[model samples]
Target: MANDLSLNKEQILDAAEQALKRYGPDKTSVVDVARALQVSHGTLYRHFASKAALREAVTERWLRRSIAEPLAQATGLPQGGSAAERLRLWLDTLIAAKRAHAAEDPELFAMYAAVTMEAAEMIDAHIDGLILQMASIIEDGITAGELRPGRPETIARAIFIATSRFHHPAHAREWNAERTDRDYDSVWELILAGLALPTA
Candidate 1:
């Protein structure tokens, strides 16, 4: 409700997130966000350029928050575990976090997907981030000699694509099944088996 001229991008994004949650992405407009911030629509545009941009910002923030903490924990895997173990742990943690997000707030999760449909560039960037994170972990594994010599980026993409059913929004319904964990373990073991060097 603070209409101060000093309203910043974070403040606008916070207000826009609230608006999007309340009205869903399709109905939430720049005017709605402005009202939430007690500012004119023009004031909001000064920060976001347009409603689509504002929605993308809000969606991006949400997606980033979902992974930021877990991603750090994943990357900071303890020194004790082998690279294969660490990689599996990191992937499991990410998949769990994504599943929890969808399960905890079905409506908001659906709304986020709706916002994404209108923001192809943002979606692409998000996927790129996921792949990059996977690649970083793969590089760590290869450096530690637990993984075979191969292109980290290529392996990362393969892992991410194979695990899509667990993390991707379109597969949310499938992610809810009780057998999801078992299904993941099977896929993860297969990936690790492929990545690990053959024993003498």
Candidate 2:
């Protein structure tokens, strides 16, 4: 294989994702990724310590791109807008992102699911990021007098737990159900009742 000096971590990850999609995570190897990149396998080792390391990187990257990044953007609510509205937008962006990722590339999604299960730290970190996004929205709501005053982090954690089925990857199968949106709306309404102020 050529000693491709320009091979960076991003290139390795892109190749690794292709390899995972083509061969599945269990069968893919660092050698396979290097082969795909036309580089020496040892070159990849410089970027990722091992095959497992490469997979973990791929999973983390996917989580950020497909989930966290979009939700991060959703936290930017307009001035004087309802925090409840911003919160709903956050959920909608999250749900749409996951559903589209899963539907458009079932193979990649399955690979992501398998690897993520083995990466608890990665999952926890990802959830923490999402929880922070939730807290930001809740904090804005409370500041605007649209929501009850409470610890935003505490309320965000509770809301995240309450709405897990709507966004969590483990519950992906139920996402396509006819009653899924209605079910989520009912859950959201209950959460809003607890958090939002009633208008006279």
Which ranges in model 2 have alpha carbons more than 4 Å from their true place? 1-4, 198-200
- CA lDDT scores, all candidates in order: 0.80, 0.84
Writing each residue's lDDT as its tens digit, candidate 1 over 1-200 gives 67666788888888877777778777988988888888887777778887778767877888888775567667776767777776777787788887887877776788676766778888888877877777887888888777898999899889988988888788888876899989988998888889998877
Q: How many residue pairs clash in all the candidates, one count each?
A: 0, 0
| Superposition error at 9 for model 2 (Å) | 0.6
lDDT of 2 by residue, 33-150 (tens): 9889998877788888888888889889988987898778768645455788888888888888888988987877776776668888888899899999989888888888889999
Of the candidates shown, which would achieve the greatest lDDT relative to the real structure? 2
Could you tell me the lDDT of residue 128 within candidate 2?
90
Query: What value does the lDDT take at residue 1 in candidate 2?
Result: 35
TM-score of each: 0.90, 0.91
